[model samples]
Target chain A: MKYFRYKEEKIFRVLMLVSTLFIVLALAIIIFSILYKGLPMLSWEMISQTPKGGFYLGKEGGILNAIIGSFYLSVCSTLLALFVSLPLALFMNIYLKRYKFVLNTVRFFLDLLWGVPSIVYGAFGFIIMIHFGLRASLLAGIITVTLFIIPIMVRAMDEVFKTVPVGLYEASLSLGSTRSETAYRVFLRQCYPGIITAVLLAFGRGIGDAASVLFTTGFTDHIPVSLMQPTATLPLAIFFQLGAPIAEVQERAYAAAAILTFFILIISILARLSSGKFQRNKINF
Target chain B: MMLQNREIRRLRDRLNVSWMIVILAIVLFLPLLLGLGLFVQSGLLLKELSIWNVLFTSQWMPMSGKFGLLSFILSSLMVTVLSLLIACPVCLLTAIHLTQYAKRYVLNIMHPVIDILAGIPSVIYGVWGILAVVPLVSKYIAPLFGVQTSGYTLLAGAIVLAIMIIPFILNILIEVFRSIPTELTEASLALGATRWQTIKFVILRKGFPGIISALGLGISRAFGETIAVLMVVGNVAKIPTGIFQPGYPLPALIANNYGEMMSIPMYQSALMFSALVLFVIVMLFNLASRIAITKFETK
Candidate 1:
């Protein structure tokens, strides 16, 4: 068994180091270039005004419409996802305790749903919009994004629910609580940090994602006044801006990317910070 | 009266059970509804053309009503497979290094970096692809290969896709390596085997199923990635036999065309069919990976 294993091992070791270096460098270069290119174009007007006439021609308007639209889209979608996901998570972990096969099947399907790309969700959402005679608007986008993030929120909460001690459920039952009461009162109380973290995480994903809302949202130049109105978003804003033949518009795309990246970074950090802050109440296993 | 009170409490609990079950039913049926919606939406196109004609032909002129999808399908498969080929080795090796060899501080530094990479918007990646990868491929790599090409070639798309998936695949691989029991590696080293030999025989053997699952999942992700690939892949509806050639993937096809074509007679249906194809391919890959993961876990 004494083969060229030693040389093979060294080769793999070097390969690992090199590849890791490459990936890290790639990440660094990406962020660095975006910041470099975008910081110059960052202006008060850029975040404060809607696209005026000839905006894509490097004119005098900003992307405030997209900034606000992205906020509304993600916040609204995350809330909708919570309403759908909470009950589903609670049911899987509590009401279906004795139903092992059904539980596994449901869990598997959720996992599959998590892996389903946002683009397919977009397509399906379009179908629904057409069926309901709805236009591509903030409302349609929110519904689509909700469908997109439900599995994510549910799975994250499910992981947290699984960490809960079975004894905790037994203890609550022994103390004369109903299953729903135990689920919402006892388990939910204990799992709030996990639940919050999951929501914020899903929110982060929803905000940054473009494909799910690309067709459904139908970008507009102004902030949407209502759920049914079309609105702009940073991702779509960047996409449309970058496609222009003008150099200034292309650079503005980088600025929009930087803004989107900044929001995502803040969300990730907030998610971690919020989880840490609330974790003090978690019952130790 | 006390008995009645207790009965009411029990009945309220029963109501809760039914409410939960109703939510569960909706949750469970969602995937089915998505599949059905995609089918029915695309059924209009299928009704017009034979399934064989649509799936196998490559000519895709929507203005003339010829909706052959073979080129898009092949392009999607090629880009995804190529990206996986590029990503799998780097991610697997890096994961092994992180878990098996790197110091704790290295892992700590790398964690946020990986998360940030994962969390960054796909549009940023697409923008970066346009900013960096495209130029690099066109000016340097393509010239080196003696090919005159735009930067928006299949290889450029593959490079971006590979980079985009590093965090995803690496996280899975790291978990796989960590799950390999320390006892096996220790026993191998105690038997006078080198660290590399131990990893080659003990760790690799133990983690093989996990590796397969990770790669499978990575493929699923790479295939359905739309914006970044769409930005760099040139959106050409032709069979790409070379890496430097432009290619149009399924998701890209759907994304680029879905917005305004609803007014066209068969255009919306064709785009919907492309989405359906993307969904099915992703599902198959994900199912295979899930099965692999289950097998490894059950072992």
Candidate 2:
């Protein structure tokens, strides 16, 4: 019986090791495949020039339209989300600090919003656009993405705020500062690094999302010059390019994937570095 | 001058209170409003097609006005279930290894890799699936099973989805396992139980609720995943006869056809209806998981 039990334990350990290795293997496979297939097609032209006519059919031109559009969409939406999420997080953490029930309920709703898939947001945005008699455009995409990322931004910042010692807030209050003053002057200053990380996280999410913008951000070959105009984004560009029957167009899709991956990689690394710095500076008391 | 100063302080307090209320209200109600909007817009489709027909009928010929969602619904279910079957065990085992057995240095390397996996965009996964998994499966795995496909099969989507959701499930399970009191494991070991026995009997029982919740979240993710599954699922509007068959899950269906939806009669409504179905299903799973996690935490 003792020997049998020992064997079982060994088997379990081996299985666990294998599972962990499998995850590592999967990640390596995904990254390698993307780099291998996408690197050759990536170039300055792909990054700098808008697509010419019939770009999806393996013709001349580049994905500059998508590159700029994704940046504009993500940056605008992240800033917009920050505008709402910062106030909301502060309101909950500072103003409603004593109301545990209200805080939990608010967090619950935000959690629900966080779980909402981007495609549903896309459909909801589509409905709103139709109701307003609006066409798919950059503004529509921004609104949809802002909604999509607000929950993520708020929740991440809220977690950072929770880590902040209550003594800091009390110290400010004891100095005769108002609640808003304490939030901005004390909590915000302490949590800015974390806040930046959260914004980058949301930016990464916003920029990579394809489903939410599928209907609201109609595809366009040119860079959007106005909020009312439609814009192409990197994910949508990859999707469109991949769908083409031409081999060269498909290769361009891989190139687009590489670009998207590069952006996300930079954001993730930045988030990690900033969070580490934040941790070192974090107050214990 | 004292009275004027006092009045200014009171006005400022009121202004602060109002600002808080306004921001809180918007943040709190926006998701609810979006849910309601999806629900009401989906109702428009009921005017053209009965709910029973849409849910029960399998043929989804939107051109002839038959907007049956059964195939898509089933396809989504099949893909999600298959992926869960593939991912849950690996995720649970990985979480166990990380929380219970792995050394610190090993974890240091593994954690960032998982984070990077989570950070990767779905579109990249799509591109990778197309370039790698599809070809590999079509050329190798399918033939071994005597099934001939172009590699864009239901199984392919499930594999990609399983990969996409492993980190998610692992993260949740790791949190749950970390919360388990170490004394339970120590007690089991002290009672002459082997490590595997202790894990199977004590840790698994304790973390079962959380594991379920994690799987629920994973299912929700798989069901609603768009680009990766879209790229590999072959996008056929049919009830898949086998894992090797091409299928159209609802998200992919909406994504592929929404552009031309207005051109066809009742099509826009049908797509909206599909989105509503997906929204409700995903929301329910999320709510259940949240409730489960909260219950576990409170316990």
Candidate 3:
């Protein structure tokens, strides 16, 4: 009986091991397939050169415009979200403790906002922008992306701000600091890493978003230097052109997808590292 | 004189308040105001909207007079259900293995990859789906069902959607299993219950709420997904004939039509109507999930 039980235990462990292996295998397949199909065309000309009339991979058509537009849109949305969500975080920390009803309602709405589909936000943006006569412009896309980014940012920032030891706040006040001073000087300093994480996450969300931008940004072959003009980001480009039967266009989309994936991977890694560093920094302090 | 000065200071301190009110008003109230303002501005368009005729009817042709949300709603539900059917079991089992079985070092190495999965974009999922999963499914899976095998179908979209949501489900379930009190497991083991038996009886029961939340969020996510489904679901603006037929989800319909609608407010309003419908469904599911989880916690 003892030998049989041992065998059963070994088999169970091995089965669990195999299950874990399957997940790793899935990740490997995603990364390897993308790289295998995309890396061959990622040359210098592909990075810096301008698109010549039409799509060409391993030639003059670099994703310079798409990259620039993605950078611009991401920067705008992230900054807007940060501006809005950080203050909300600070307010949640500062007041609303006794106002449980209002506080809970706000919390619920924020959660709902976070969970609302990005595509819905796109529709909302489309209607509002069209009414304003900004049809398919970069401004519309930025606004759409902002709505999607804000809720998550607020949630992350709120969690981080709450975890900031209350003693830090009390101590600052006892040392003759004003409420604003204490918030900025002490609470902000402690929660900076979490804020950075929120920003990075929003940035990741912004760059890779396709559904929200489909109607808002419209489609343009040329990169626009101005925020008012329509522009194409990597995700939009990938979505629009990935289905192309032309081998060259499809190849360009693949390379662009790889670039987008690489960008996301870097942001996610940075978020983890910064958060980890913050924990260590706090421990040391 | 000194005593008089202290009294004055106390009175002044009692009367003066912090500017916390200003901060709260700016952060919380401003957005609410904006949302309200936008709603009011769009009220003209919404005034022409009828909840019954727009939402309940099954004909969605903005070009013609008929507008039916049935196909879009059905398609969204089909994708959500099928994707969850594929992902939930895998995720739950994976979570079980990770939380209940894996060594600490193994968990550490594996967790980041899961995070990477969550970080991957929907558009890339679309790209990958179109290139790989759709082709494989069209070739091997669809012909068995007597439907024309193409890269774009409900099955292909569901498969990609399942892959996209598995990480989310896994993340939640891991948290759920982690929260199961260790004493319950210990007590079960002391009574001669095997590990699998203990898991089946105790762990699964305790983690049921988390599991529900995981599935809820996963379904909500897959339902809301647009780009991936749009790219692969063959954009046929009709009801799917089977699991293999082409379909158009509500969000996808909104996406494919929103920019093209210029001649009519009805068209834009129809898109808004779809958005509102999607939003309400998502919000309802989220609220239900939260309430269920809370009830479970109380029990």
Candidate 4:
């Protein structure tokens, strides 16, 4: 029986090793396939020029409109989310510090929101837009994406703030600092690295999301100059291009995907670096 | 001067309290508001089709006024369950290895890979599925099984989703396993139990509730995943007879039809109803996970 159990342990260990290797293999395949298909099609014009007529028929064009639009949408939404999330994080860690029940309930709901599918947010956003007589414009997309990322930003920032020592708050208060003052001056300064990491995380989420903006952001070929105008995003660009019957257009989809992946990789690396810095700065008390 | 200072402090406190209330209110109530909005929007469909008929019937003809969602519901279930089946054992084993057996260098390489996996967007997975998984399955796996498909089947979606969800489940399980006391494992080992037995009877038992919650979270994620599943699933509005057959899930249904819903009568409402269904199902799973995690933590 002992020998049998030992053999079982060895077999299970091999199984675990295989599974781990499988995950790594999958990731490598995804990256390799994207680069192999995308690089040959990727060109300076593809990144600089807008699609012309019959672009979906493999006509000459670029995804510049989507590149610009994704940047605008993600940047605007990330900043908006930060404005709301920062104050909320401060409030939770400072003013409502004693109300553990309320804090947990809030965190629970935020988790639920985080878990919600982006497509449902699209539906909800569509309903709200219709009620307000709003069109599917950049503003609508920004709002929808903002709603999508607020929970993420707030939760991440909240976790960072939780790591802060209680004594620091008490010390500031004893030094005659107002709660608002201390939250803004002391806590915010201490957690800024974490806050930056959270922002990057939210930005990555915002830029990559296609479902939440599917209906809310009406697609267009031009870079949106006004918030009221429809904007194209990279994910949607990839989706539309991939759906084309033409093979060249499908290759363009690969190029678009490669661009998207590159953007996310950079953001992930930045987030990791900032988080490492955040850990170094974290108060140990 | 002292009185004036105290009054200023009082004013600041009041202002802070109000700000807290406002922020908390928005943070807590926005999701409920979104849920309520979806519910109200779906009322149009409820008015048109009896909720029972909408849920139970198999035929879904938007043009001819049939609005059944049973097939979509079933397809979603099949794909989610299949993906969970594919992912759970592998992720569980990987998590066990990470926490128990892997050396530091192995962990150093593995941790970043999992982190990178977690950060890859769903759309990239969709493109990868279309580029890689589809052809491989169609050309290789399907033929081996004598199942003919274009490769865009429920199985393809499940495979993509399983890969997508591995990091999500593994991350949670690793945390749970790490939290288990080391003494428990040592005690079992001292009793002359093999490592497998210790892991099975000691670590797994202690982490059982967390594992359940992790799976619950995985289910919620798999069920609600959109772009990747939509890209791979063949999007035929029918209950799949086999994993090799093409089928449409609810999220895919909404995504494929939402743009043209205005042209068909009651179509928009039906889409809204589908969104509501997805929302409720995901919310229930999320709540279950929260409850499970909380229960385990408190214990």
Interface RMSD of each: 1.7, 1.6, 4.5, 1.6
Residue B295 lDDT (model 1): 77
Candidate 1 lDDT for residue A267: 84
- DockQ of every candidate structure: 0.71, 0.73, 0.44, 0.73
Q: Per-residue error at A263 for model 2, in Å?
A: 0.8
Clashing pairs in 4: none
Cα lDDT, model 1, residue B166 = 88
The best candidate by lDDT is: 4
Cα lDDT tens digits for candidate 4, A156-230 = 899989988889999999998888888888899888788998899899999999999998999999999999999
Show the colliding residue pairs in model 3: B59-B68, B60-B68
lDDT tens digits by residue: candidate 3, A1-285: 866766776676676677678778777788777877888867776668657765643335777778888888889999987777776777677555457677766776677677778887776677668668786778889998998888888887887877877677778779876665566667788777888988898889888888888778876767786778998788877766676677778888888888988999899999989987765335223
Task: Put down candidate 3 lDDT per residue, B1-299, tens digits, no spaces.
Answer: 98797677555443322343454454455344434544554354457656676666687767785678888898889888988898876787788899888788988888888988887899888878877888878887876766567768888889889888888778878877887789999999999978877887899987888789768878778888888778888878777868888888888887777656656766766666677778768767877776665566556
Q: Encode model 2's per-residue lDDT on B1-299: one tens digit a residue.
A: 98798678668867777877897898788877887887687776798778998999998777787888999999999999999999998999899999988999999999889888987889888888888889988999999999888999999999999999998888889999999999999999999887789899999999999999999998998889998999999989889989999989989999999878978647888888899889889989999999999899889
Off by over 4 Å in 1: A1-4, B1-16
Task: Quote the chain B TM-score of every prediction.
Answer: 0.94, 0.94, 0.86, 0.94
lDDT of 2 at A14: 95
Off by over 4 Å in 2: A278-282, B1-16
Candidate numbers sorted by DockQ from highest down: 2, 4, 1, 3
**TM-score, one value per model:** 0.96, 0.96, 0.88, 0.96
Counting clashing residue pairs in each candidate, in order, gives 0, 0, 2, 0
Docking class of 1: medium
TM-score of 1: 0.96
